[model samples]
Target: MRLKQGSLLWYLYLDKSYCLLSVRNVKALVEYFHLLDVHGKNTLNDVLFYHFLHHVTDLKKRQINLVFDMLDWSAVGEIGFEQFYVLVCILLAHQNHLEEQFMYRHSRTVFDLLDLKGDLRIGPKNFEMYRFLFNIQKQELKDLFRDFDITGDHRLNYQEFKLYTIVRINKLQKRQKKTEENAERERSLCSRKCRIK
Candidate 1:
């Protein structure tokens, strides 16, 4: 909900990779063309209207529009952010609570940016959601995490691992964003605070 330096960085990174497609010559691309509405919604049309279509070449417009339409929620119109978020959560849950965990991790990062504490952990009431997230295809989270080996060894130190992992993730993401933004700004500016005179 609240965007902080860290969250902004994460968004920018994801945006750059998924939306921007790592286009080195950003002048050729529109920024918004890459956001996926939280629920696999039609964010592309919004971009087309607000940013892309005007800037991109005519040939690119038709191709982009077709792709955008296909990504829409109902194929009738675009999906809203909240809906997109929910759909993504549900899919990430994949029949269990993996989606919840993913959101919890994200929420924690948000909290860190706000410098406030929030309870983003899963509780008994929501345990069923986790089960639903991964159990659909006979996937068990316990085994999955075991395989993930959070410690990078063979066992998980549950009490210490995830918290550390999430915090480091948030920090690394923020740093990456700062680095990228600096590079982007430098790339955009042709002169170094010097007058043409």
Candidate 2:
């Protein structure tokens, strides 16, 4: 239950004990985690670890909860390598991104999914995917620099580019989080209603 240094290495050996019905899903999750580890070398800082549930795959969470729900397995509310692997498997089995998208679009699913409203709280307006890379390149910046030149001078400095990138990422994250929260809230309400009814 407790994650330690040899966690991942140990899991590699132990996972063979359980027979998973869908091996492909397991492989996909494993690959996903591999990529995550590679890319998150720097991005997976202490902050990410502290909020590690965000990164966990659905499969992994169940395993952790079942095993370590009673124990303080995650000291900082974060799962380490072995715990991460278990969660990833659980995520693949239960967490359906497509389903989440559908629920968000059709109706806000829960507070953790998306917040369609302007409010930071979770709601339905958040799950719409309007952009494809091609659409972005074709429509939004068609002229690219038509209005970018503040003084009618056609050029962008390093500072301008840096600031733009920062602003863009922050905006996107905020919007996404809003949508996620909305969907999550909707889902929660639905479940509660179901239980009550």
Candidate 3:
């Protein structure tokens, strides 16, 4: 539940080639769309959508609604193949540990998703509802707002959001690097101990 920086926990839980989908991936997704279309409506209602989300992700249930909301743009209570495809892509990206990259690539979409009320911008209030989706803590989000809200109006425009994504990606990379370095040190120490024995 905590967003551990070194793992997928940092982002809304999901994977990566999955990120760079080949045509075959798209074809398989089309088949999946058909399989999930139990009502033959070529759309997924909240029920079907929730089921699909549960099928792919390991718990952390609430984040699903935010994602579902992102896809259910028309507020029609149903989503079509396109939206479903995007959701799957997001899942794949997260699963492959490519969330930072995915966010960077799809910043606008993410910004729109965060701007829950169709507002031109996003602020802490909007983020509070979807915070579980990113799993950020109160202090971290406060830091984010303090640093990124360039206009000091307590909201983020698309450009500001884009900058935030870049900064987030950098922080993730740094954390991953530090984790790798620590693992290498552990391995090196273990080898030395083994050789000494």
Which candidate ranks first by TM-score, i.e. highest?
3
Instruction: Give the per-residue lDDT of model 3 (tens digit) for 1-197.
Output: 22234432223333342245657667767777888899999999988888776665654557667667777888999999988867666655655557677777788877887777787799898877766545567997899899999988999899888998899888988998999999999999999999999
Worst ten in a row by lDDT for model 2: 125-134
The global C-alpha lDDT for each of the candidates, from Candidate 1 onward, is 0.37, 0.37, 0.74
Off-target runs (Cα >4 Å) in candidate 2 are 1-135, 142-148
Q: What tens-digit string does per-residue lDDT give for candidate 2 at 71-188? A: 2243444334555554333332222222222222222222222222324332111212211201224333333234332334443333332343344446556888999999999999
Q: Which stretches of candidate 1 lie over 4 Å from their true place?
A: 1-87, 90-153, 184-197
RMSD in angstroms between candidate 1 and the native structure over all alpha carbons: 16.2
TM, every model: 0.24, 0.29, 0.75
- Give the per-residue lDDT digits (tens) of candidate 1, residues 74-139: 655564443333333333233222332443455432222222112333322223223332232234
Better of 1 and 3 by lDDT: 3
- Candidate with better TM-score, 2 vs 3: 3
| Candidate 3 TM-score over all chains jointly | 0.75
Per-candidate RMSD, Å: 16.2, 19.0, 5.4
Give the winner by lDDT: 2 or 3. 3
> Which candidate's lDDT is highest?
3
